[model samples]
Target: MDDQTRLELEAAAFRRLQKHLMEDRTDVQNIDMMNLAGFCRNCLGRWYQEAAAERGIEMSKDEGREAFYGMPYADWKANYQTDSTPEQQSAFKESFAKNVENQTP
Candidate 1:
C-alpha cells in the first residue's frame, strides 16, 4: 500500500500488458489501437522512457519500444504493420488531439 509497493504493482501490470500485446495481439496494428484507444505501443514506449528517466536511468525510445514489442520496433513494423484506411487515419487524428488535451499534466 506504500508508494514503493504501488509503483512496483503498476510496473508489473505494465509488463503484463506489454506481454499480452506482443504474444496475443499480433493482429492488432498500432494505427487501429491509436484510433480506438487513443494510445498504442509507441505511446507505451514513450511512457517507459519517461519512467526510466524519473529513476535517473537513461533509456532510449528505441530501447523502450524493444522492451514493449519483444523486438526492434522497425522489425515489428516491417513484419506486422498494415496500411491504415483513410477512415482510420481521420479518426486517429481527431482522437489524438483529444487524447493529448486529456493528458495535459
Candidate 2:
C-alpha cells in the first residue's frame, strides 16, 4: 500500500484498540496490562504525545490522554479504573523497568 494508506490503516487500528480498552474492556486494569503486555492506556497516550511533538503539534500529556480516552484522565480513572492487587503492582514495576524504562530512546 501507499504511505498515506498505510498511515490511515495504522490510525484506524489504533482507534479500534483505544475503543476496545476504553469502552469495551474497561475491566482490564492498567497495572495488569503493564505487567502482562508491558504497556497500557497511559503508555498509548504518551506515544500520542510524542508523535505530536515530532510533528510540532505541541500536545501535552493530559491532552494526549484526553484524545485517547475521549475524556480527562482523572474522569476515566474514577469511572473505569479498578484497584490492582499488591502482586500486580510488584509485577508491573518489574515489567515496566525491564520492558520500558530500560529501553533506549
Query: Which of the numbered candidates is closest to the native, going by highest TM-score?
Result: 2
Q: Tell me the tens digit of each residue's lDDT in model 2 across 3-82.
A: 99999999899889998998899999888888888889998998888889989999999999998889999999999888
lDDT of 1 at 22: 82
TM-scores for all candidates: the values are 0.82, 0.92
lDDT of each: 0.85, 0.89
Global fold similarity of model 2 (TM-score): 0.92
lDDT per residue as tens, model 1, 69-88: 87899999998889899998
Worst 10 residues of 1 by lDDT: 96-105
Candidate 1, residue 17: how far the Cα is off, in Å: 0.9
Question: How many Å off is the CA of 102 in candidate 2?
Answer: 1.6
- The regions of model 2 sitting more than 4 angstroms off are none
